[model samples]
Target: MKTQPATTQIGWLGIVLLLFLAACAAPPNSPTPSPVVPTQAPSPTPSPLPSPTPVARSLRLWVGEDAAALPAIQAVITNFTQASGTPITVIPKPPDALRLSVAGLSLSGEAPPDLIWADQEILAGLLADGYLQPVRASGDALPGLQTAATSQSQLWGIPITAQNQLLLLYNRSRISSPPTSSDDLITSSRAAQGGLVMVWDEPYWLVPWLYGFGGSLTAGADGPPSLNTPAMLAALNLFGELAVAAPAEVKTYRGGQRWFGEGEVGLMVDGEWALSEYRSLTETLDLGIAPLPRIPATNQAALPLISGSFLMFARDLSRDDLKPAEELAHYLEQPTTQIELALALGRLPASMEALADPRLQADPGRAAAANQARQAPGLPPTKAARCALFGIDVWLPSLLKGNLDQAETAEAMQAEAEACVTQ
Candidate 1:
C-alpha cells in the first residue's frame, strides 16, 4: 500500500506540471497585445499667483517747533508703520525754515517731503502754486475743521490745532466781573493805572475791531471790500483811543503776556496758550478768560481764527506709499491722539470728540476758546483770504511796525493783498 501511494504522488506532480505548461503556452498567431501604458495622472489645476509685496519706501515729513507734538506724531507714525508695514521718517524743522525748504524742493523738482505739518496760512501759498493735492473734501477727514481751513471746495490739509486772535486774559485781582462788551473793556482800561497795555501793532489783533465795527476783509456776497467803510473808520477811531490809553512803551511792547503776567497791565488780548506762561505769576491773581469783547451796538464777537493742518504731498505715490500716509493721518486725527496732543502741547484738538475730553473741559479758558472756534465765522474759502488777513512777508512786518495810520495801513494792505490775489 506504501509503494502504491509514492507512485501515485509522482503521477499527480507530472499532471500538475503539464497543466501549468498548458496555461503558460499561448498561440503565436494571437494578435500581440498592446503594452499597457501607465495611465497619466489627471493634470492638477494650477493655483493662482499671490499678489506682489509692496515696495519699501522712505517718507519724510516736515513739522514745526512743538517738542511735545513730536512724541504724538512719532506714536502715530509708528502705529501706521506697524499696521500698514511701511516706514516713515519725521523731520522737525524750524517753522521759519520749513517754507524755504519746501520752496527749494519744489524749485529743484527733487527731495520734497511726502507730507508737511504746517500752518494753514503757509499751505495757502503752496496751494496757489499747485504744489498740494486736494484732499477731495471727504467727510470727517478733518472732523472739526472749519470751512475756513479748507480750500477750493476741498480740504487741502487736515487741521489738527487752532488758535484765535482775540482772547481776553484778565487779572482776577483787579477785576471780579470780566468785561463783556467793548465799552466795558474801554471803561476798565481807562480806570486802571498803566491802562490795558494792549499789545500794539498786531494787525490780526486789530481785525477784531474791524469785525466789531461791522467791517470785513472781503465784501459780503454783493458788497465791495469794506476797508473804507464807516464801520471800519469807527473801529480805527476806537483802536486809536485804546492805543492812547496804553503806555508810551506799548508801541514797543511785543506781547501783552509779559505786561499782564508782571501785573503791569489789567487786561490783555492774547491767545489761550498764554495761560501756561502766566499761571505762575500770582496764586491770588485770579486768571479769567473770555472771548474778545463784542461791539456794544452790533453785539458781534470778532476773532481771527488761525489753524494748522497735516498735508500730504505724495501725489505720485503708489498704493503702498499712500496706504501708510493715509493711515498715519488718520491716526493723528484719532480722538485719543487728539486728546493727548491737547493736554501735552496745549493745542486744541481738531476733532469734536477730543473737544469733549474732560481734561480739556477742566480748563474753562481752553473750553471757551474751543467753543468759540466751533462757532466762529470762518474765513472765506479762497487762498486770497490768507494774504488779506496775514499780509505777505514784507508787508506783515512793516504793517506791524505801525508806520501808517489805520486808514492808510488798511488801504495799502488791501491793495497789496488784492495784487497778490491777481498775481
Candidate 2:
C-alpha cells in the first residue's frame, strides 16, 4: 500500500511543504532565515510563475481584531510606520469576514489588501483558492503556533499570538479553586453564587465537549461527514445536563459578561481574547483561568480549539509591494513588539523569547491560557473544516434550545455539512 514517489504522485502535501522549509521552526539564533517560495506557495499553480513586478504603493492592512484590541495593534503599526517611514492605512473588520472580504475584493479587479491580521483558521481556505502568498518568516514563533498556521502541512502565514483559546473561568471570590474534572465543575457551578452557569450557547463552546468524548464533526481527520456517532449524542447530552443543572439568568453574551463581572455568575467558558477585559476587573472580581476540566467517563479533558492572529500576505504582491509588508511583519515578530503586545493586551506571545520574558511571566492568567492552548487540537483550517465549522455554528442553537435532540441534531449537522461540500 505504498504511495508513488514525490515526482509522480505528489498531492497537496508536497505543494504545501514546498512553500517553506520542512523544518518549520528555525534555530533560535540562526544567522540566516529559512528559504521560502511565495510564488510556489501552497496552491498547485502551473510552473513558469510570472516574475515580480515593481509597484509603488503604501501597505494596506486589514485587521480582524476587536475594537478594544485596536489600540495595542495600532501602537505596533505606529512604531513600524515611524521607524521605516512607510505610509500605511489600517482597517478593521470582523475575523470571520476577513477571508470572504479578501476573496471578493480579489475578484472585483481591485488589488487585494497588501496585508491582513486575522485568525489563522482562514489561511487554508485562502491557500486552497490561491489567494495568498506564503511568507518567509524568521521561524522563531512557537512551534504550536507554526503548526496552527500550517494547512495541509504548508506554512502560509506567520503566527502573531497564541491567544484564541477557550478555557474554564471562575472567580476566586466565589470558589477557592478551579475545577479539575467535569463532576467538580458541575458541583461547583451549582454551589457558586447566583447558582447559574454563564454559558455561551454556541458551537465554538461545544467543540471541546464533542472532541473530549471522541465525537467528531468529520469522518476520521480528513473531514468527511460522520456526525451521528454515539459519542456526539453523549457529548450533547452532557452539555444539556450542565445547562439544566445551572439555569442561566443572562440571555445575551454581553449580559453574561456583565453578570460575570458583577460577581452574579462565577463560572464561565471564554477565550483568552477576553483576558484584557477580565484582567481589568481585578478590583471587584478575582478571576481564575484553567483548562476545561477532564470528563470523568473518558478521563480526557475537553480539547480547546487553538488558533491565533496571523500576519498574512495577498497573492498578487509584487516584490516592491511586499517589501514594506515584510518589514512590518518582521517588526511585529520582534521580542520587544511581542512583549509590548502581551502586556498591553493580556495575550500570549508567538515569539518564544517574548513568551519567556520576565514581564510576561508575572501574569498568571496568560500562563493558564498557554497551558490550555497546549492541550488543544488546534483549529483545523482545511476546506473541509471550514465547511464543517459553518454547519456546527448553524446547528448549535437548535441543539442547545432542545428543539432538536442529540440524535436529530447530529443528523441535521451531518446532512447540512455534506450538502455544503457537495454544492
Best by lDDT: 2
- Native-referenced Cα lDDT, model 1: 0.65
Tens-place lDDT digits, model 1, residues 1-423: 436688799999999999999999985786789999999989999999998986778788777655766887677667777876767788887766676767687576857778778765556566665767755322242332546545545677766665543578777777776788878888888775436855555566666777677777667422233455577666766777666557655554454556667677778777665677667767544677877777877777655454545554544545556666676667777777667767766767777667778889898777778766664545654646655655423243454456766577666666777666666
TM agreement with the true structure for every prediction: 0.76, 0.71
For candidate 2, what is the lDDT? Answer: 0.75
Task: Give each model's whole-structure lDDT.
Answer: 0.65, 0.75
Backbone collision count in every prediction? Answer: 0, 0
lDDT of 2 by residue, 1-423 (tens): 987787755666776777666568666884787799568558676899788974446788888888888988988899888888887778887877877787687476855687878877667667777888878788478765776666655677888877777778888888788889878877887773634454446777877898889776566445576666788788888887778645456788777777777777778887776766987987778988888889989988887777777888888778877877888888888888887887887788887767667776677777766665555665555656666766777786898877998888878877777778777
Best TM-score goes to which candidate?
1
